[model samples]
Target chain A: MLIKRPDDIKPSDITDEKIYHQRRAFLQAGSRAALAVAAGAVVPGLMFPGEAAAQVAALQFKKNARFSTDEEINSLKDITRYNNFYEFGTDKKDPAKYAHTLKTDPWNVRVEGEVEKPADYQLEDLIRESQLEERIYRMRCVEAWSMVIPWVGIPLSALIKRFKPTSKARYVEFTTLYDPAQMPGQKRGVLNWPYVEGLRMDEAMHPLTLLAVGLYGKVLPNQNGAPMRLVVPWKYGFKNIKSIVKIRFTETMPNTTWNLSGPQEYGFYANVNPEVDHPRWSQSRERRIGEFFKRKTKMFNGYEEQVASLYSGMDLRHSY
Target chain B: MMMYRMKPALIKPLVFIACLFPLVFGIWAGFTDQLGANPIEEITHRTGDWALRLLLITLAVTPLRRMLGWGWLLRVRRMLGLFAFFYACLHLLTYFVLDQFFDWDEILKDIIKRPYITIGFSAFVLLVPLAVTSTNAMMRRLGKRWGQLHQLVYVVAVFGILHYLWLVKADYLLPLIHAAILLALLLVRAWYQRQALSTRRTAPQTS
Candidate 1:
């Protein structure tokens, strides 16, 4: 029972994998064909054009070059196909293979807890109200692999200011969409249903933090955490929770999924410190998604200039 | 009885070809750039998977021989053992060459200190003598000692399975499957050994 019967669809309505590929072949001459053909393309979403085109509508945003990395970004194929969205499935490829089933058409984000605005915000209205910008950032996984992703979204600071947290709000906790019907992986207890992640209020309000709505100038692919996901550039990849449904401004430290799974391996402040190796493997070096030889991993994934001051006095090794 | 009648000469080549399939297919996938985003990781995992799979398959042979009463299956066991060693070599090569990039200092550190790697590396090292003593000439030279030495395979199997168990992050599905298979095979072998000992004790000894 690796793949359970999805509740949303009648068994007959489900597209067979064979016929799905055949249909992709039939539509090969169309716009979606570019993804199937874009083998070495640098853009992230091109590799999943079918998933992108079926649900992802294009977005308009200003390019913030000051914050964006000049380094060549990994192809959309690499970013979209190679993911750590455990909600979709534990395998990196599972998201792209199965995330098409996630119904995000009428999505909403509930902003609760200590926030002044405690209401369910529609995904569309929030995107429209927030000032969107495209920022390219390097995301390093705890597994010692890295990817340069150009994300289109509003800064977390902008969204935080709009929400207006109360005095007691010390942490911002995020929760992923939870529906076993849409997310087949949720049916199994991978890391407790409804993945949870939290950041200190200051960290959440940092200028670099992004609530990414799209990727590579297009709506974020479902596999890549559409209609939106949190992208914390300086922290390990797991900190960037995807397919977020709830944002809670809390007084106490919230329990994150990975930290709860393995407390020794993961920490509350999972800043990418190359010095602090994971319990199982070394983090001194990371293989960039498209590169051959392993390169020396940098402190805070090369965002030390912007984020170092945030943890200036704190011992990263202890926090990690 | 029918399987025992099957010619080893005919089956040996097929087994050899079957053992080589994973390597050939992995190379084909590599050349096509179909190994996905992280080709190095993909290649490492594929090779490691085949190595463990072959090891498990090799372990299965003894129990199958006893259970089905196909004593002739022993003739094929050496080739399977060697193939397991061969894939294990490829698996180590992938990690050593592709992942580490000849970084001996790092490799040595991993082998010496890292529990998962330490266990896996020790298992691979244990496999070397078993592979070396597998030849018919060496088998005859060592005589009874050969059987004692090859018992190391059972220890190697435990280490190999433990290596996989420790390495996986959260998904224990595959490792658990491998553990179950190895456990069943070992249990069956132990049961057969006890049965053999009891039968020998009861039987009239001409010697």
Candidate 2:
């Protein structure tokens, strides 16, 4: 009986694809359970195991989409656990611990202001019409940290086009859910209550922008902004608002949360430009969430070729 | 008085090991992978926090001695100050080695440019001389100058708090707490100095 080390085993001896995938799925579920335990949440093991499996099975999205990046997708645990959703709290782990109270089901998004169809639409109905695509994007935070995430969503353009923006709509404003009972952090005046973010009309209509519904092939965990969120890869993560409840199109530039909080620190155009440093810290380098060494932050977070044209003549230093 | 009743040899070693506990815990946390999701930031923050905390603890020794009449507290003051320096060194090393990876040009630029980094780096630079001259022989050699040289700790503490305040984007609760503690400590020292001054004047008139 010879014991073969992992390195000594040849590719020919590898497990079958079906078995491998099944094993991977089991590991993923086990890790999620471990994460729940780590966060001091009651383990869902008492519930039917089949029910959890069925939920995972039902979450189907097209794979290897054209928009997906080649970068390694961050672990599902990291994506779910490490978050900056201030609605829950300021600490990174606060959201994972406190976001359980949020009720994402029966959610409705009200599209209003400069739109032809100004009415409340069910979140499910909005997602049902758009084709879901898996996009692996580099998400750079204004805090000088980065993560590569595989997001499942439809292009934001698809959702915005449905509302039919009038010619007067030159800017788009997004609002996060604002229930203090559910979101404990809202009790404190962290950022003038409900977090608001915005983008230029052309930027909102860009193909790269996504109205994310899920991540890592699962319905988003509450901490990761359940039901729906925004994903603007080229801009800072805050610009990609979370738990969005309303999207309004207007002729005037909307006042974003951070920009209002500290106008000197945060600007309207929160593009990921390394050359433009944040007032208190350098943006030239960013630590990839789990990695030890900091990497040079790429211009527009490496999507420069695609989105750089949007700000051809503008000074990023001033606008950042 | 209880601490004085104990032998200096035994108490000194105990204090030495106790002062090193934070660095040991930090190392243990790193090896055990318990530094959380962002290990670099966690390690950087932990070391920095310990450094500031120990510096404040070191500052509290004089007030504690005068208020509680525990002169033996002075014995641990040097050790506490050195431990503060030790953690400060670890904090700066983590930034240079792990965060910046010895990119001298970038590190230099950060020290020159970023206000938070500039103040933080200056605080570390000031600590280096105090740490170097911490030995009994140097204290003996410098005589009264040693006390004057070590007054720089107050300035270092100021920079440490400012560095923290500037770095955090929002939720300044932690830094504000540190600020309050520092303010109280400084006020206590000032109040004590005023008391000593008035006592000296009264004694001369009475004589």
Candidate 3:
């Protein structure tokens, strides 16, 4: 977040504040090392070669009971290995195998459009002040499979509030990193390059919305969209765009990648509704990752109690 | 060339074991934990793939025999065709028992409402009669009509390709390759038919 007007800062105004100061020694060490980060001249990895870059800042996070579900999480191996990151490849296992090519340590998220404090944030600087929350939620894929994942991140609303979106910010658009060299799938025309996703202003600020930086209490593996990825639990998995590079706030609804690829099949609001079947198959039932028998899929992936109000009068069938 | 010279005693057993390889590999994969996270999906996909592949292989027999004069290819055609049906049955059983867990309502809904499943299941149904009438007695009883009845293999193969093409979300490469092979086989048959017609016209009339 851009702190252009430092004078107006209040403790309450500290949007998406999470204290990642888990290990005091790490923070004390981090503060000393932050001089290199703050200097912005050198790559941290070059300065300290061959260390576990992902472990550089193991977030000290606690589970947020208010938003977390008690559902059993999928095995970490399954969660990490079986991903739908089309950037790496179209196959379910492709991301886990090919995503290592992505250079994530020196990442930057360029915030743009309709925000008072639009600025590019280094992956570390963006979440350094934020305390992490582990929220377990069910992720339903449009392909009729689902996984329960425990994601660790700050509430996206807190992050949005920090950005201080203007009234014109009716919708928030996200774009995935576009370099074909790192993301080999971009070389093929499987999807329009640089995957895009969007959420309404209200949905962006919804407490359930999380910008996930880690998975299963570890720094997110590159396959699972390392550094940062959006986690809107109530929607289909694709709506949670990975490896986001830009956030554009728009008055009009943004065009999402899947929707653009097949408008009749995918929609702007990809809420998980069993009533509306996918063009290819039935949406009513889903095969859980390891389960033998299929389970009846719930509306909004069983998160309707919290989020149904967001689309109360609107016909989900039409919007879907 | 040596394969054609071999007796049915030697060749049929080899063909039978070769046909059983996919199922054996799947069962082995299941026990060894190589079936990945979703074994059910893996099983369903493998059976379906082999079923389609065997159907194409079965379709190729007549063309290869006619073009290259490998008359012995016809000896194994029935076994190849039966193997296609075997795998198709397994593919349908995988969907009916494993994927849907024998929920008749859901299975019926899929067959009637879902286009991909409808095509795939319909293709399986078309193969049942072909499999049942493979006996020498039934072939002799039907006589000339038997060849006409067996021609439904072409229709079933086409539907099988369509079923595969419709089921995928994107990345239609595999399905399209199957479709291209089917198209080429059809073209070859049509060309052979035209050549036979022209030769018949040029010859003296039997009347």
Model 1 shows how many backbone clashes? 3
Ranking by lDDT: 3, 1, 2
Q: In terms of docking quality, how is candidate 2 classified?
A: medium
lDDT of 1 at B134: 93
Off by over 4 Å in 3: A1-57, B1-9, B205-207
Candidate 1, A102-144: lDDT as tens digits: 8776677999999788989877656652256678999999999
Q: List the residue pairs that clash in candidate 1.
A: A43-A76, A44-A76, A45-A76
Can you tell me which runs of candidate 2 are displaced by over 4 Å? A1-58, B1-11
Candidate 3, residues A8-96, lDDT tens digits: the string is 32434333244223432233256535643553423232223222454353444666655666777789888987888988887888987
- RMSD after CA superposition, every candidate: 10.2, 9.9, 4.9
lDDT on C-alpha atoms for all candidate structures: 0.81, 0.80, 0.82
Model 3, span B1-51: residue lDDT tens: 775486646777788899999989889999998887788888899999999
Lowest lDDT 10-residue stretch of candidate 1 chain B: B1-10
How good is the docking of model 3, by CAPRI class?
medium
- Least lDDT summed over 10 consecutive residues: which range in candidate 2 chain A? A1-10
Per-candidate count of clashing residue pairs (backbone under 3 Å): 3, 0, 3
List model 2 lDDT by residue over A1-320, tens digit each: 01112122222322223212211132346665444334322112212232243124223455534456787778877887789998899989898888877777667899999989999987767785225556789999999999999887777877777788887888899999999998999998878778899989888877788888767765667787876899999999989888889999998999999999999989999999899888878898998988877889999999999789888899888778
